[model samples]
Target: MAIRMHAALRRCTWLLALGWLTSLPATAALPEDPFRSPMWEYNLARYLGADAAVRHSDTVVIKTPPFAEDATQVPLTVDLSAFPHEIKEVITWVDLNPVPHLFTLRPEAAEIRTVALNFRIQQASTVRAAVRDEQGGWHVGSVHVEAAGGGCTAPSATASNPDWADSFGQVRGALFSPVGGVTGTRLKVQVMHPMDSGMVGNIPRFNIETLELRQTANQQRLASMALSESASENPLFVFDLEHDAQQSGILLLLRDNGGNLIESRMGI
Candidate 1:
């Protein structure tokens, strides 16, 4: 009986070793454990599939504040301009949030390779950005954000304000000169909406469903993004305007899930 027990233990050890080996990354240079959650394996298997291979990439930059003063409105930026060729789509999420998937952006124009948005973080979480290339390979970027917690379940700030709906869908925008030789116009835009995630209070999910940025002079579409309930109230976006935004200005058009439309322009 003792010999049988010893053999069972050895079999278990070999299975564990096999599991770890199969999980080894396709690229050894890139670490695979960016999620850092105890359920990282489970989450990746569920979200990315067991057969998916993700490569860590410096070209796909994920930026977030080290500490979030307001967890409900934590800022996030994903830039893949460094590898600006044949990007299929970009997916972003907060690993620890109740609603993990924040947004998905598929740029109609290849020149628009960056996205900036605000999202909620339930607690300390690793924010992730994954870009799918033309070949279907995914390049990933991640950042750790520290928060005080309750961002997801907290009451909506817009619901409490009482004046949010009056300006719902109104977009205010501005352009700023390049800072520290960034070589692009800093385009900042804010849209008025509650962006209620439905996790807080009795609020049902009412948020901006889609938004597009266009050059006002030529009406050329620059970038478009889809936002979900994971977005914070009064969603704010700041992005790099490459060429025409400074000269021709830009227009922001957005629509909420409730079928409300908002359009505004800057530098017209």
Candidate 2:
């Protein structure tokens, strides 16, 4: 009698799952077809609450190439110039990655309207940038990036190095005059750390926790961004700096999940 009851429950569960799957539209957003339908409903509802609304905006642009040559270091740029003053925060993530949440940036000033970032894509996924306005509305911009294979579950290249610990928090940065329609002085920064999410084999979760960019002249903070374990190992970033700022340099301060703080300066 117990065996028969268990079998009956299993059959009912299977029927329910089948019904749910069949109820979805043919163009439904699934793991196989992420671009056809935006697969961000779960993430958006979870992070921004179920009542939050997300709409497409021309002002919020996510720029990336159609195909990424390197799945582990695809270059992306987010532009928030249209609603600069109204933007309260920006959150970026990949739709299909094992751990999707990438980072969140809260601009301390209106000058921080654009940012260039490097992150990993597990597969062909929809990368989204959601900007929260001062009035509490979320504006979304997304782009599709294709990769030949996976990135998130792959073993870290830098993590296996014997010398990784010696240079864990080492930072390198430089500033260059804007070219190719990029405004102001472009600040490029690279930090050494394996942003492991623990999804890959025996690796445990380790990532950069916080990043602060400040002007050296007045010690005034320009922006603060928070990163999650979903970020690529050895994260890289670029930001546009106001051309007429008083400083000839900018300071970089970062803290990792292990609570190690490292600071450096980049001359403009």
Candidate 3:
């Protein structure tokens, strides 16, 4: 019995070693590039999870500068008036932003279409804007924003928050405001989260794991940005009015990787 137990332990050890070997990066760089190769698989529709039937439609327009002088506060705009009842929602993403999809703003009605926002970029990167039409179709737009510093790995964690450390990956967030009326009426929704690259480290553990936003918050979600580390710090967002936002109902909600929710409410 003693010999059998020893053999079992040895076999387990070998398996663990092999698993680690497979996971280890080929190069021993301080911080490795998350992208393995150039011909990597990448499809925005599949990545953004629009739908199997959803085709790329050129129905939406994104407004932003061709280049940015400051990456921290790159301005962006999207007009919904061009879209009729077909616009489901409008979404934006800063490829280099620490948390791309800086925020997802959901409109209450198809009538309300224009939106303007500011996002921070960590470095020079491409920015994408997508629109979800009324029939559940998706339209996309792309731009490039340049910046000097990246917001990821920023020493901006709040010590009071519990999940601040693991917020490296994408986080799920929302902002809801009653447009013209309350409950079931006109409303706008937004999401806040980090699109972690999994290249960063946990200061203490020095370990890396798959960090991403869960589907629970994403499926019910109207739109999202597959962001990188180039996004800004404490992303701020806004959208046009559709429904009547009542007092105490206006708010921006966010949850870190551990599912702790933090909300900021506007008194209206």
Q: Pick the candidate with the highest TM-score.
A: 2
TM-score of 2: 0.78
TM-score, each model?
0.77, 0.78, 0.49
Of 1 and 3, the candidate ranking higher by TM-score: 1
Q: What is the descending TM-score order?
A: 2, 1, 3
How high is the lDDT of residue 101 in model 1? 80
Better candidate by lDDT, 2 or 3: 2
- Please give the range of 10 consecutive residues that has the lowest summed lDDT in model 1: 26-35
lDDT of 2 by residue, 1-268 (tens): 9999999999999999999999975632222233554556788776666677566767889999899788888888998767554667889988888778888988774266678878888889888888998788788787888888577777889887988899888888787776686556677888988888777877887888899988887777878899876677888898875544734678889998788888998885
Query: What is the lDDT for 1 in model 2?
Result: 100
Consecutive 10-residue window with the lowest summed lDDT within model 3: 205-214
Model 2 clash tally? Answer: 0
Clashing residue pairs for model 2: none
In model 1, how many backbone clashes occur?
0
lDDT of each: 0.77, 0.79, 0.47
